[model samples]
Target chain A: MKARVIVSFKDEVLDPQGLTIKNALHSLGYKFIKDVRQGKVFDIEIDGISVEDARKYLQEIADKVLANPVIEKFHWEIIEK
Target chain B: MKARVIVSFKDEVLDPQGLTIKNALHSLGYKFIKDVRQGKVFDIEIDGISVEDARKYLQEIADKVLANPVIEKFHWEIIEK
Candidate 1:
C-alpha cells in the first residue's frame, strides 16, 4: 500500500512563509490572488499494510513528528497499488 | 470563482525539507515510510472571473512568482462557489 500525508498549519496560526509568498505574488502582478497557504505532502510506500494499520501508523507519525499539534493538522490516506 | 494552486519541486530536484521530514518520521517509529515529498497549496478567491481567464492569470502567476520554472512546477484550477 502507498500512503499520502498532508500537513498544514491550523487556521488560527500565523503563516509567515505563506504571507511571504502571497506578497511575492502580489508584486509579480497577480493582483487577484487573495491568500496563500503553505503545506506539505509526504508520499510513502508501505507494503503489506492494511488501510487501518497505515492510518494508525500515520497518525502516530503526525502526532510525534510530522506536525506540531499545537499549530498544525495532518491527515493521511492509504492507496492500494 | 476560487482558485487552487499546487506547487511542487520538479521530479529531478532534491527536496531536503522532505528528506528531513522523512527522517523525523523514522525517528518517531514510522519505519514503514519509504519516502516523503513536500509541496505547497495556495487557495485564492477570484470574484467574477471566467475559468479561462482565471487559468490564464494563474499561469502568469506561476511563471512569474509562484515557482522557479527551472526547478519547480505549478498548476491551478478555478473553483466556483
Candidate 2:
C-alpha cells in the first residue's frame, strides 16, 4: 500500500516559517497572497499488509512519530492498496 | 482562493531525511514500511484575484521559489475559491 501523510502545526501555533515564505512572496511581487501555512508531507509505501492493518499502523505512526502533540497535528490516507 | 502545493525530491535525488525517518520507523518496529519519501507542503490563500490569475501566480511561486528545478518537482491544486 501507498500512503500520504501530512503533518502541520495547529492553528493556534505561530508559524514563523510560513510568515517568512509570505514575506518572500510579497518581495517577489506576489502581493495577492494573503496567508501561507507550511507543513511536511510523507509518501510511504507499506509491504505485505492488509488495507485495514496499513491504516491502523499509519495512524499510529502519525500520532507517535510524525507529529508533536503539543503543537502539531497529522492526517494520513492510503493512496494505493 | 486557497491552494495546496507539494514539493518533493526528484526520483534521481537522494533524500537523506526520508531515509532517516525510515530508519527511525524501522527501529520503532514498523517493519512493514517498504519505502518513504519526504516533502514539503504549502497551504496558501490568495485574495482579490481571479482563479485563473491565482493559479498562474501559484505556478510561478512553485517553480521559482518552492521547488528547486535541478533536483525537486512540485505539484499544486486550488482547494477553495
Candidate 3:
C-alpha cells in the first residue's frame, strides 16, 4: 500500500517563504492572490500490513518523523494501488 | 477561495532526503517500508475570483512559480470555503 502525508505550518505561525511567493505573484500581475503558505508531502510505500495496522503505523510515522509537533501539523491517507 | 498545489519529484530522480528518512525509519523498526519520496505543497487564498478564472489562475501559478518543471510535477485543486 501507499500512503501520503501532508505537513503544514500551524495557522498562527509566520511564513516568510509563503509571503515572498505571494508578493512575487502580486508583481507578476496575480493581484487577486491574497495569501500563500507552503507545506510538504511525503509519499511512502508500505509492504503487506493489515489495513487497521497500516493506518496506525502511518499515523505514527507522520507524527514522529514527518512533522514537527510544535509548529507543524500533519495528516495522512492510505492509497490503494 | 483557496488553492492547494502539490509538487513532487519525477520518478527517475534521486531523492536523498527521502532516502535518509526511510533509513531512519528502518533503524527505528519500520522495516516494512519499501520506499519514500518527498515533495512540497503551496496553499494560497484568492479573493472573489470566479471559479473558472480561479482554476486557470491557480494553474498558471503552479506552473510558473510553485514548482520546478524540470524535475518536479505540480497539480492543484481549488477549495471552497
Candidate 4:
C-alpha cells in the first residue's frame, strides 16, 4: 500500500517561506497571485499489511512524527493498495 | 482559483531526508514501512484571471521557482475555482 501524508501550518500561523515565494513571484511579474501556503508531503509505501492496518499506522506516523501539533496539522490518504 | 503544486525529487535521486525518516521510524518500531519519499506542496491562490491564464501562470511558476528541473519534478492541479 502507498499513502500520502500532507503536513501544513495551521491557518493562524505565519508562513515566511510562503510569503517569500509570493513576493518572488510578484517580482517576476506573476501579479495575479494573491496568496501562497507551503507544506510538506510524504509518500510512504508499506508492505505486508492490510489496508486497515496501514491506515492506522499512517495516522500514527503523521501524529507522532510528521506533524507538530502546536503549529501544524496533517492529513493523509491511501493512494494505492 | 486555488491550485496545488506538488514537487518531488526524481525517482533516480537519492533522498537523504527520506532515508533518515525511514531509519527514525524503524527505530521507533514502525517496521511495516518499506519506503518513504518526501516532497513539497504549495497551495496557491490567484485572483482576477481566467482558468486558462491561471493554468499558464501556474505552470510558469512551477518551472521557474517551485522545482529544480535537474533533480525534481512537479505536478499541479486546480483544487478550487
Which regions of candidate 2 deviate over 4 angstroms? Answer: none
- Against the true structure, what is model 2's DockQ? 0.93
TM-score of each: 0.81, 0.98, 0.96, 0.98
On DockQ, the leading prediction is 2
TM-score of 4: 0.98
Which of candidates 1 and 2 reaches a greater lDDT?
2
Rank by lDDT, highest first. 4, 2, 3, 1
TM-score between predicted and true chain B, model 1? 0.88
lDDT of 2 by residue, B1-81 (tens): 899999999988999999999999999999899889999999999999999988888889999999998999999999989
Sequence-dependent TM-score of model 1? 0.81
Ranking by TM-score: 4, 2, 3, 1
- Could you tell me how far off, in angstroms, the CA of residue A43 lies in candidate 3 after the best superposition? 0.8
DockQ metric for all predictions: 0.59, 0.93, 0.89, 0.92
> How would you encode candidate 1's per-residue C-alpha lDDT over B1-81 as one tens digit per residue?
667677888889998988887787778777777777777767666665667788788888767777788998887776555
Chain B TM-scores of the candidates: 0.88, 0.96, 0.93, 0.96
Docking class of 2: high
Model 3's CAPRI class is: high
Interface RMSD measured for model 1 = 2.1
DockQ computed for model 1 against the true two-chain complex using alpha carbons: 0.59
